[model samples]
Target: MIERWLPAAASAHACALDAVLFGIHWHMLLIFTAWLALLVVILIKFRQGANPEPRPTEARRLWPAIAIGCVVIGDAVILTTLALPAWSARIAPPPANVTPIEVRVTGEQFAWNIHYPGPDRVFGRIDNSLISASNPVGIDRDDAAARDDIGLLNILTLPVGRTIVIQLASRDVVHSFTLHEMRVKQDAMPGMTTRTWFTPTRTGDWEIACSQLCGLGHYRMRGELHVVTAAGWDQWMKDEQVRLTR
Candidate 1:
């Protein structure tokens, strides 16, 4: 039922996070039912209609303590067993023997700057002084490695069935890079770089939203996330390279 309303899970980590969420909801429901049952029992046993006179002294019962303990135990179980495992699985180092696609994402007032290292797989130097309307990422095009660098605004294209490692940062203020379908949300802060990795399990196009309220234009801050098949990705890369070299 919970999965029905959520966006399609397009990444490996999405299912793991969903499992944790489902467990938490079930635990909450059980606790609510237990408390409601206890309330009903108390009302029936101690009501004035049932007992004409009430005693000043009350008998100590173990059930209340047990119920509280159970709640505590349930929380601990969820934190250690379900939540931690899912978090670790997503944050773990890239899988062995897998070549991950890496990209740099920088968030500004109302846009996401997409930087892709060309075939060299090495990003070029970024000079803060070179930042302008046309050059969002401040790439030094004269550099050999930067000659093939691809910079796009509000568009990120990735390949399916592969690990994606993102070096996230902010250009001005704090912003959350949110990918709903991919189960990815991370803060991109200024002057600091944060690394996040995930493996895409399906192919689809989704909206990348800025979950954080950065400025007045936050509502209009949106980007496109495209996960395509291997062949499609290869062709896209080839076209981009040809266009750049031409």
Candidate 2:
């Protein structure tokens, strides 16, 4: 299996990449052998003594046709076999049975504001006038939805095998949410919400980084994504809710 070839804590994206790279490597091997054989044949057969009388053969005419046909067929097969699965897993609509946990990720001038919906499953409304260091995201703490909000600078945790829907937006400049293991990367534009989803298959602590440059702190814009078992995640969520309530 493709996953077996990748790291034990590999995400869905990593698995897709592994599948694609495996196919590409196999293609490269075939191409290398074919080209090398062709070169050797040409060298021996086209030499001065080998073919003194250069005959115009129909081989050249069929070569181009054959190459084109092969290209088209190969592309179709590769796209269908390797690339489609990856794209579907990341971009396709979620299954009817899966209930995704929503996480609002807002990119600011220097830091990331990760707002979890607590136990309400709803994000709090934001008011521009209340925006300040103490209330970074302008979250209306009075709103019941925001009362239990656990805002973290960079740490992100998710339950393994559950689809997580991330609503991404930038508060100031452009930013990107990229997790190498998860293979989920999308740009967060100011005043706009970008959605990306991923189901973590492995349990581990992974890096959360901004792949796009927003400002001077771009290099330091780092976070951690903790993927844990369902029971572990439930315990964490319960603890978070209890702490927020206090």
Candidate 3:
């Protein structure tokens, strides 16, 4: 319901997002209602003709102290009950049995570089000057990891149950990597790497878009993420391998 009304700007950190939002929203609604009613009552009860004399100044002074107290205490509870747990879940330790798949994600002037670790589970060094469709990862080819890596742009996919660790970096300015259904979004910054992880429970096609405005072609800097069933993902990988070799 929150997603439909507020619609997450992108995928949220995890399931914890909704809980935190629920708690904060409930408190906010109560506060707003109380404040609104107080304002309405004051307007009606304090008309100039209705009262010959004003209330003592000391009585009004106490209102600010009371209101601030409520606000401060309310916020503390929200942070303790709502925000902290959600943040923890976002950066919590991965379980021991979880198999992590590594992918190097690089953002450039107007495109994305997705490098899949080859059979050796590594990505080869890239040569900028030799970039071409056939050499997507910019792999030296002689390098074992580059030789078998399935590299491409515009389209990417992941297996439904596998946990994916994305090493995000930017070659130019900043850009955001977001996947809506899985609720994972992170920034890609130049000279520093940011990491994001997510395990997709639902399988479907999703959008990979840049949330930040980078340049004239920012809108065009978009792609698709296809989450599939385990068997379907395996088939896609096999197809990619064949495509890379040919």
Which parts of model 2 are misplaced by more than 4 Å?
1-9, 12-17, 48-61, 128-135
Candidate 3 residues 158-226, lDDT tens each? 887788888999989999987766667789999999998877767778778888899999999988888
Model 2 C-alpha lDDT versus the unseen true structure: 0.80
Looking at candidate 3, what is the lDDT of residue 141?
73
Clashing residue pairs found in predicted model 1? none
Which model scores highest in lDDT? 1
lDDT of 2 at 162: 87
Ranking by lDDT: 1, 2, 3
Off by over 4 Å in 3: 6-13, 57-64
Residue 81 of model 1 has an lDDT of: 92
lDDT of 1: 0.90
lDDT over C-alpha atoms for residue 43 of model 3: 82
lDDT of 3: 0.78
Best by TM-score: 1
RMSD of 3: 2.6
Higher-lDDT candidate of 1 and 2: 1
Comparing 1 with 3 on lDDT, the higher-scoring candidate is 1
